[model samples]
Target chain A: MTSLVIAGKTFHSRLFLGTGKFSSNQLMQQAIETSGTEMVTVAMKRVDLHTPEDNMLEYINKETIQLLPNTSGARNAREAVFAAQMMQEIFETNWLKLEIHPDPRYLLPDPVETLKATEELVKLGFVVLPYISADPVLCKLLEEVGAATVMPLGAPIGSNKGLRTKDLLEIIIEQSNIPVVVDAGIGAPSHAAEAMEIGADAVLINTAIAVAGDPNVMAQAFKMAVESGRMAYEAQLATPHREADASSPLTAFLD
Target chain B: MNLKLEILNHNNMNIIINNNSREVAEGCTLERLIDEIGYKEFKFAVAVNNQVVKKTAWDETILYDGDKVIVIKAVSGG
Candidate 1:
């Protein structure tokens, strides 16, 4: 029911989808539509640049979906900055997902480069949503640098590990001045629910839904889970106590 | 006779776009190159010599012989 307002734009869905790993572009479209996500991430690469046919954008319903281009292949600040500028120039959206991972194996975010790029991108008048490790201090620094939101990973990208960095993510979510979007390592709808229960403004998922037996059905499931989790959080579920007491009371004093 | 000879003498510049060698009209601008490549409806970015050539500069930016141009598309990624 509640909308997520990020960078002055309101999103009706708290579940943001990543457009990758689908069997086909058509399938990806079906999943995206079923998920009801307003924002989706796209990656830029040299191979796709030369081939005009089979372009991914053709499948995305741009009228309904807002494209969030990511700096996925960039390994440092300079490369990420270049990718961001290129993405804005081409995609016609200033919203950028700044991801700089020098490591090819785990695809972890480089905190130093992310900080450097965020500061630079903010100064360039771009709405920056940076993906980083679930480091609370980094989240604060990114906020100070004027990032639109902080997207911290629950685990390594595409690992399907499901919230391996739960403690760090909770700290970030608790202290973040900007929206904390839980991104990466979410294997199932339950993982999304867990992230939402902890007060994440949004959860970004890709590999989990894309690789499911039925991606469209899985998308719907995640959407429902995210909505239910957000609703539960808003309702203020009662906290559990360390010890249980009898409803009638264990004993009466000096009766 | 002179017009036919001039037309036949004209040379197209050879350049590498996204690692594919192609020939374009002499003194072609990056804007013209994009138009020639039939990417009018698609969203893409251009880089020459590993340096990004901004969209604002496309019209005035001339492509030189043997320049390495990279055209990239924003596809699905996580």
Candidate 2:
């Protein structure tokens, strides 16, 4: 399997993990270790900030695990920018996962504000990875504005709907110069495998593994699937012919 | 002549903290209030009346009567 290279950093695993919805922080940590994902996402929020030993951070903070703090609750470009700055101030990392969704119900990303925010964040010397819809044009625009990586969601956030936007994602993968990390709604290992098979730089799984009956096992499964799929893609998969030839050779083309 | 005595420390001051109405001592600095609430050495973000107060400024940033203070920390979210 080819290693994923994003912004001069090399990641051995193509499966990026999201630290959310797990039964416990211990379980989340175990699943992350099992998955072998070098990159993981953590959301910034207003909780018990004074507790130096936040359960999730205690579990995931390591030299090996790179935390990409996301602006999940931001409703606009300004709010997202503020959240990103806060993350930088608190976490001491310029890397930010920009998420701007005004609508709270479905949590759909606003393409206009996302593009605007990506440009601004990039200018602010941040390694911005904006989570956006599977719009090929928007991905190109983000690339033009200097995004470190473009994370396009496969389906809705946490719906476990698999790659419902497969066609658009395929277009995005084809056109993007930066890494295309398929970011949400990956239901199972097979779904992750399909994404890797289609040449996505990586797949970010959260709800599927976090809410699994056995997250550790599920993480392992996704790790294997991602590796396997990347290997197949690297080996050059042959395209299947639409029409199958008859065994008896009913019509000899050579004749 | 009639005069109304202002008892500052004798009466509990009503204030809004983390969106909850709470009684704290009058003239409490944010740092002292935070320490009083057992949040010393804890990593958190604070906002007073919608303005964020950094950790360095918390010492001088005092809570006033009816002032809304918001204290937030990291949580499990995606």
- How many clashes does each candidate structure show, in the order listed? 0, 5
Candidate 1 has a TM-score of 0.90
Q: Per-residue CA lDDT of candidate 2, range A1-255, in tens?
A: 567888888999888898889988999999999999988888766544234544456787569987888899888998888787667655667888899999988899999999999999999999999999999999999999999999999999999999999999999999999999999989989999899999998999999999999999999999999999899889888787889866685766876
Docking class of 2: acceptable
| Global local distance difference test of model 2 | 0.84
Model 1 per-residue lDDT at A174: 88
Candidate DockQ values, in order, are 0.61, 0.37
Q: Using lDDT, give the best candidate's number.
A: 1
Predicted model with the maximum TM-score: 1
Q: Least accurate stretch of 10 residues (summed lDDT) in model 2 chain A?
A: A46-55
lDDT tens digits, residues A1-255, model 1?
A: 688999888999999999999989999999999999999998887744444567788888888888899998899999989888888867888999999999999999999999999999999988999999999999999999999999999999999989889999889988987899999999989999999998999999999999999999999999999999899888877788899866686676878
Q: Which runs in model 1 stand beyond 4 Å of their true positions?
A: A47-52, A245-255, B1-10, B54-57
Q: What is the C-alpha lDDT of each candidate?
A: 0.89, 0.84
